[model samples]
Target: MRLKDKVIIVTGSTTGIGKAIAKAAISEGAKVLVHGLEEDLGLQAIQELGEENTVLHIEDISAAGCPEKLVELAIKTWGKIDAIVNNAAWVVNSDIGTTGKAFLGKVLEVNSIAPFLLIKSALPYLSVSKGVVLNIGSVNAWSGEPNLLAYSISKGALMTMTRNLGDVLPRTHSVRVNQINPGWVLTERERQHKKQDGLSENWYEEIPAMYAPSGRILWPSEIAAAAVYWLADESGPISGQVVDLEQHPLMGRNAPKDPSTIHGKP
Candidate 1:
């Protein structure tokens, strides 16, 4: 087991990519603190992962002091901390015209500020264990689709934090930080989001090839697999990387040409 005896805290892990990461860590013999906003979901995760291997933490991360509380619980229960996966996020649609100060602030609080607080609170323990921090970011962090203005800004800030911490922390504390920016993952949350936008129930089957180059979007498990590498000792002292997990090249690539243009349609 690559992560044998490690103690990991994964926030927003009741569902989607976060849930998958918690399961992966536990599968590798790590004990996990599975966090989520809903008590029922957290309890479900604890049941699924087994009580001996997991602890359920229910909290709204945006609330003050919640990040520190989570870190304290992990230490109190397990005696030490080995890793943290900052996976919780609050995503909402907001174009320039629709975005307001309060809306933007809320997004930043949950998606950006909470992660920083958690890292700060966990720093002392991380230093002692020489642990790792894996931040779950998004491809939308680059510039984002116009509709996701606030969300994009928050994620972009998180990417910056990941790089900044990754560089400085390892030098003195031996703690490593890294981030992964995933593109077009298909989770239950995504399904609902698309459905709200008027997509049909079977929308996944109808995604254009231009958007889903591999005939499908990414799965939560795929992201989990990559996370294990960064979280485990096998990775060997690497940090300060922002990996874009996407099929298309994220930079210096032309947009896909229209098929009709090739056929010379008038």
Candidate 2:
């Protein structure tokens, strides 16, 4: 019961890492407001999590005024908000050639702006509760793959927001903000996306050695497990921090042309 009696609003809780975090929070005795798009998926998640522990709110996270509405919904349901997990993201592939201003704008709206607005909306209650804010970011924020240009920029913005809020909010409002940068989680969305990209349905099972050091990527549950520590009082006064959760060192780790044969030839 690490999170006993806390009320957390988890955006994008209908699926993937967000859903996993909501589940873990509930198991740790937290009440969760599960927000997401896709009415059926939202209902399904609520059913799985049980109405006693959660309430469902379905909305496009990027829509205007959504942040305000979500804050209102959580307050209405739980009477106070203890924390928020900004986990909703708009992920689409784009490169230098395919990228456009409008596309970049929309991606930033979902990934970075919404989280900031949500925090702003919830600030009052959070101040009262001395709450926590956890932003779900990608390792790509450091500088992403070429194909993930706009998404990377959006995440980079989110990362900066996390750090900025983490610094000021904790001091002024006693609200702790932090970020988790996850690398290649094997979530439902990941599997689906890879399959859509023409990979075999079981592509995850046979990942290249360079990508999956341990024959697998991180799991949503694993990320959730780490999330619990930061969300709970256990983390104590730690703010303005960004943690990278990846199998290997993210920066300057060499990828061999043929690892099995080129072991000592680098």
Candidate 3:
């Protein structure tokens, strides 16, 4: 077990990539803190993973004092925190020009600021365990996501935060910080987008071949594998790096060369 006896906190664990990461962590013999705003889903995750291995905490990370409380709970329950995956973020789908000020603020608060705050709160506990921090970024950060303007901006901020945190963490405390930027992952929210746009869920199926050169969308499990790896001591030398899960074109500047090699070197 890579994470034997370790305790991890994964926010937004009720569903999507967050759910997959939480389950994977549990499988690797780690005690997982399942966090989210949904009480029922949190309980469901607890039940699915078994009460002995998982604990459910219902709280909005965007809320003030919430990050500290969460870290406190993890310490109180398990006596230590080995890793933290900042997987909580969301947007209602609006471009910069169209998005309201409140919407933009909300996006940054939940997607960007909250992650930073959580890291700060968990630093002490993480330092004791020489733990790592895995923040969830997105392909939208670099791509021209006209529809997700605020979200993109927030993710962009997250990348910068990941780097800055990594740089300072090692010098100050032994904690390491990094991020995983996943490409067009088909989460429930992403599926809703396809349904709303009146398109096939597999419309982007050829994207990996046509655009990504990988030939398919990134599965939640694949991303979860990377997260689990990063949580272990093996990822110590990989701090401050932004692991892009997007299938970058295998050809010229931005063109696909081969679909089978989408997971190849960038």
Candidate 4:
């Protein structure tokens, strides 16, 4: 019960890593505002997390004033806010040639701007409670693959927002902010994304060892476990930190050479 009596808001929590974080917070004795765009998924989360301890908020976060509305609903349900996990994001495949102005605007609106708005909307409550904000970022922030140009840019903006707010909020309001840049998580959405990219149903099984370090990609639950540590007071008053959650070193690591190519056998 590390988070006993705390109230948390987790955006985009209807599925995947966001859903895992909501569940983990509740298990640690926190009441949560579970948010998502899908009503059905929101209902599923309410059923799983229990109505007594959870509030389901359905909204397109990129819409105007939705962030403030979400914070208001959390306060109405729980009387205060202890933390907010800005986990909702919109990702679409687009390279320099394919990324249009409309698409780029949409991507930035959801993936970058929405989180900033959520934090701003929740700032008053967070200050009152001396709360924390955990932003779920991506390792792709560090120059994503060419195909992920717009998405990479959006994440990079988010990473900057995290650090900027992390430094300012803690000093000015006693509210902490931190971010986690997760790598290659194996969620249902990810599986579907791979499928859309022409990967077969057995794609996970076919991932080369070079990609999946532990014979598998990262899991939402594993990310959730790390999140709880930051959300809880056990992490102290630390802020302005970005953790890259990946098996391989994010910096100064040589690309994995193909075994067959190196051995000249195949």
Best by TM-score: 2
**What TM-score against the true fold does each predicted structure earn?**
0.95, 0.96, 0.90, 0.96
What lDDT does candidate 1 reach at residue 114? 98
Clashing pairs in 4: none
Residues 98-186, candidate 4, lDDT per residue (tens digit)?
99999999999999999999999999999999999999999999999889999999999999999999999999999999999999998
Where is model 4 more than 4 Å wrong at Cα?
A: 259-266
Which of the predicted structures, 2 or 3, would earn the higher TM-score when compared with the native? Answer: 2
Question: Model 3, 68-101: lDDT tens per residue?
Answer: 9889889989999999999998855787578898
Per-prediction CA RMSD (Å): 2.5, 2.2, 4.0, 2.1
Q: On a 0 to 1 TM-score scale, where does candidate 2 land against the true structure? A: 0.96
Worst 10 residues of 2 by lDDT: 257-266
Q: List, residue by residue over 23-67, the lDDT tens digit for candidate 2.
A: 999999999999998999999999999999999889998898999
Worst 10 residues of 1 by lDDT: 257-266
| Prediction-by-prediction clash tally | 0, 0, 3, 0
* Full candidate order by lDDT, most accurate first: 2, 1, 4, 3
Best by lDDT: 2
Clash number for model 2?
Answer: 0
Candidate 3: residue 219 Cα off by (Å): 0.7
In angstroms, the error of model 1 at 247 is 1.6
